[model samples]
Target: MNVFEVRGGKKLQGEIVPQGAKNEALQIISAVLLTPEEVTINNIPDILDVNLLIELLSEMNVKVNRTSRSTCIFKADDVNIDYLHSPEFKKKSGRLRGSVMLAGAMLARYKKAFIPKPGGDKIGRRRLDTHVIGFQKLGTQLDYNQEDGFFHLTAEELKGTYMLLDEPSVTGTANIVMAATMATGTTTIYNAACEPYLQQLCKMLNRMGAKISGIGSNLLVIEGVDYLGGTTHAMLPDMIEVGSFIGLAAMTKGDITIKNAGINDLGIIPEKFRQLGIAMDFKGDDIHIPSQDSYTIQKYLDGGVLTIYDHPWPGFTPDLLSIVLVTAIQAHGSVLIHQKMFESRLFFVDKLIEMGAQIILCDPHRAVVIGLEREHQLRGITMSSPDIRAGVALLIAALSAEGKSTIQNIEQIDRGYQNIDTRLQALGADIKRVAI
Candidate 1:
């Protein structure tokens, strides 16, 4: 196992170009299976999850070549769809949660897919009913062998139809968009996730000759095409990483500049962080995060407690809620952090509380954070990372504490962050990665 040993109280100072979005990388890499031509994708994040997805593609006989640190050339010339059910492949697919998306790509290409149960954070019961239900709406017959934990989706010809999703599932929307792009009729997706990553998917699909309307809204009307040709599309910068850096700079009192942040694609992030008194100044495509020892939580005009809640897209993302909660602990005022998406996310607050953070776990999904404001420093503590966002949250908390901190289970962090220790070290962070 690997652990991150962080020497606390180091201010991050430098410019960082965020890596490619991991969420998008997984979905896009899976999309390669839809066509049997050489498709080049740029700005690929070399994260653990992406690497795992690439291995999944390789097992399916897709030729993947790493052309650069952030580029790859993929050709799914001959897809062995049945290989996805092999025990070895199944284990790799189970390594990360994003493996479920392969079902869509395989079904689109070979008309049949068998995907094992995905493995990821036990944040809560992350259900696949949303994925299955969406595909079933497109004329897919779903069968599962629970003994082997495999889901079989078989569709002769997918017919597009109207779908009101059970919820705004990010990956579910991606799967449906991929499946519907090659379907026979016009597919109108309501309550789809229009995050920057999803927008990238839509843009790439459009470049491949799929007529898609409603680019940045809840409803996506995708007109199916007979076939999609290969095209080049650049992935967007990692907004989650950008937000994490912004939160780190604010909490650690450091000045940092993020280059080519694609500030326009950021949906409600600046205003959302501004609610916590964290503001940024943009110069064209760059974002400058100024140093601040502390800032007051912008109280409601009614003089009541401020609440920061996470919702679907066009609102705050639940993934960033943990980072915001950690940031609020370093600010000067109190605020309520509500994570509505996952039930077990707030349970990690016990680790922060043990390190002297003033947080009250109001419930399974909510926390009330009282800021320390540098008057009281969080003492060094040993903790284990639970998930990707929570792991990064603990890393931020560890970096701002008074003494040394040891954080294990960094594989969770590796799932989302591509060489995060190296990235932070480049920004003057006192963090080291070592095998334990």
Candidate 2:
């Protein structure tokens, strides 16, 4: 395992560019399987999860050409369908939750797909009910093999139909949309997830000759197409990283400029940080956050404590709630963080409590943070990363603390952020990756 030894109390200053959207890369890369023609993707983030998905594609005999670090050309012309049944395939796909998306693309083109019990951050109960039910609604027959722990889906011919999703699950919606792309009729999906990543998928599919409407809304209409061709697509900058950088700048009193931040697509992220009294300026497509000695949290209009909660797109993202919580530790007032989407995400606050922050763990879903206002600095301690988001949150806390901190299980952090330690080092952060 690799751990990060972060020596805290150093202010960062430099310009850093956010990588391509990790969420969008998962969906878009899977979409290449819908066509046998060459599909070129640009701005791909060099992260663990996305790279694993690409490796899975390569193992399936997709011709992959890496013309640049951030660009790849994939042609699924000679995909080996038999590889899906291989033990190697199962072992690898089991480690990545994004592997579930391959099912929809495979089913759309080959009329069959296999999905192992997917693994990802153990944040909560992430069920496959949404994906399975949506596929069944699209004329796919599902079977489960208990011995191998895989879901088998087969369809002689997919026929599109209307579906009202139980929840606006992002990956579920992406899977169903891909499966419906080559079906026989019109498919209408209501209550669908309209996050920017999903919209990017729809637009990319349209460029590839799939007919999809309602790009930025809950209602999506996809007309079945006979064939899809190849197209080049670029990903938007990762909004989660942008939000994390904003929080990092505030917490450590750093002057950082995030280049090509894709600010318009960020959707309430900057405003949410601003509510915590973090000041920023927009420079073209960049976000400039200056050094701050202290920031104050905003209260509600009625004098109630400000409550930030996660909702669907156009609302605050659940991924950044941890960043918000950690950033508030050094702020001037109190705020309530309600992580409605995942029950266990707030559990990491216990580590912050050990770092001398005033936090109340109201429950599994909510945390109340009384900002220390820089009156007392947090003292670093040994910790372990629980998930991707929480790992970055802990790294942020460690960076702003008073001494050296050792963070174990940094693989979770590498799964999302691209070359995080090297990038932070360029900004004058005293962090090093050590193998243990």
Candidate 3:
């Protein structure tokens, strides 16, 4: 296990670049299985979960070539279909939630996909029904074993039709789109996730000879092609990490320039931070945040308390709600944080309360943070990270606190953010990684 010892109250100043998008890497890597030729992907984040997926691919006989720290070429010319049912695959596939995406590509290419129950942060119940239902809609028969915790899917020449998903699940959309790309007919997916990651996936598939229309919209029409070819694709900068840096600069009172932050794809994130009265200046693809001694929260025009919530795309993302909640702690006013997509993410607010921040856990999915406004500095303490987002939120809190703070279970942080402590240290943050 690893722990982060942070000495707070130090103002960070420097330039940092956001890593490649982790979510996009998952979908893109799995798409390699759709084609037998070589697929070169650039800007892949060297994070724990992604590495695990790459290792899983290698274990399945996909030839992987590492060209650089952030670039890789994958050739799936001889994928071992028999390995899918092996104990090794079962063990490796269950290590990350993104592994479920392999089922879609595997089913598209091999007509059979076996997946163990995927594992990830236990913030809430993440259902696989969306994935299963989407696969069934594409002419795949699904079977599940409760005792063994495995999903077995088989199909004979997938024939696509119209599918209106129950929800616009990010992974579900990617999986169904991948499966539909090689199907026999045109597939129309309504209410698909139009996130930049998904859009990038669509672009990559198109370059690989898949006919996909409506790139950045909810309704996607995928005309199944007989085969897909290899293509080189570059991933966009991680928007979640960019959002995290914005919150870190505000809460710790620092000046940071996030280089190549994919600013155009970041919808409403900076505007949401501005609602917390943080000053952000944009120059091309870089975001500059100036040090602020104090910031004030905005109230509604009707004189009501401010509320920040997550919706689908073009709105706030639920992944950054914890960061928003933590950054609001030092603001001059109050705001309600509502995480509508998942439950139990707000439970980490108790640790903030322990650190002398005024917060009310209204429910499993909502919290009201009363900003201290620098009237008093937060006193740091020891805590355990609950999940990836909350762990980063706690790290931000520690960076802005008064004394020493120790955060355990930092592996969760490593799963998403690549070399986070090292990146923060380059910006003058007093964070040290210690093995325990």
Candidate 4:
């Protein structure tokens, strides 16, 4: 592994072009297995999760070639479905939640899929019920041994119908969309996750000869076809990282600009940041972040103290709660950070507290951040990254601290952000990647 040794207190400046969305790239790569033809993907992120997904694809007999640093061509003309059930596959699946999506892809193409317990941030119970339930609606029979953490699902032909998901589970929504691609009839999915990543999945499927309407809305209408042909598609930019960099530039009192952000697709992320009194000038797709000495947290509607929280799509993403929480520490006023998703995600505030941040960990799920502003700058301290978003949050925190800090468990950060250290270094950030 890799560790980031950052000497904080320097304002990061310059520009960065974000790579493709990690979440989007993961699902699109898996979608290649649905057709026995060459599929080209552009703007693929250079990250661990993408690499792992490519490894899984290779195991399935897909001929994957790295055409460029940020592009790949996948041909699954001779895929072997049994590879999806291997122990190596199972072990690798636990690395991230994206692995769970493979079940739907395998079941759609081979009419059978074997999957082990999926892994991701242990924020709370990341339920698979929505996924299994959706598959069952398409005539899939699910068999499993809970003791061994393996699942086997099979069906002869999938017949789609109207289905309401138990909840708007993001991965579950993506799974159903993948499985519904080649089903026998039309599939209507209500309460679907219309997040940007899922929208990218729909676009890729459409290019692959799957008929899907309602790309960015809750109700998805998918007309399953007999076969899906391969095609080339470009993935979207990472919205979470765009949000992260926005917060980073603000908290450190720096001037920076993000190059070529997919501004039209950001949805409510910019507005969410604006709620905390962070705004920027839009130069086409790039956001110009100016140096600000302080930020005043906006009051809540109906006149109360300010509070920032996370919800499902079109609302703020839970993955960015940590970033938002840490950024709140540098604003001019205090704000309540309510993380409505996971139980243990906010516990890392103690680490920031150790670095002299004024944070009240109200409970397992909430933290009230008292902004330090210019009164106190964080003192550098060694910390371990707990999860993907949290790890980057820690990195952002360390970047603004007053001394040298060593951050371990960088693989957690690597799973999400593509070439994070390299990108940060380009922005004049004093960060170096090295072995611990």
Candidate 2 off by > 4 Å: none
Q: Least accurate stretch of 10 residues (summed lDDT) in model 3?
A: 142-151
What is the lDDT, from 0 to 100, of the residue 62 in candidate 3? Answer: 96
lDDT by residue for model 1 over 1-436, one digit each (tens)?
Answer: 8899998898889999989888888888888877877789999988888888888788778898888978888888888867877888888878878988887777666778886887988799898888899889999998888777788789999998999987988899999898888888988889888888888888887887788999888899988887777877688888898889889888888899999987998888877788888868999999998988678889888989899999888888888999999999978889999888889998989999999999999899889999888799888889999999999999999988889999999989998998899988998999999887
CA lDDT of every candidate: 0.87, 0.95, 0.93, 0.87
**What value of lDDT does candidate 2 attain over all alpha carbons?**
0.95
Winner by lDDT between candidate 4 and candidate 3: 3
- Between prediction 1 and prediction 2, the one with superior TM-score is 2
* Each prediction's TM-score versus the true structure: 0.97, 0.99, 0.99, 0.97
Model 4: runs farther than 4 Å from truth?
A: 146-148
Highest lDDT model number? 2
- Candidate 3 Cα misplacement greater than 4 A, ranges: none
Candidate 3 yields a Cα-based lDDT of 0.93
RMSD of each: 1.2, 0.7, 0.9, 1.4
What lDDT would candidate 4 get against the real structure? 0.87
How far does residue 248 in candidate 2 sit from its true spot (Å)?
0.6
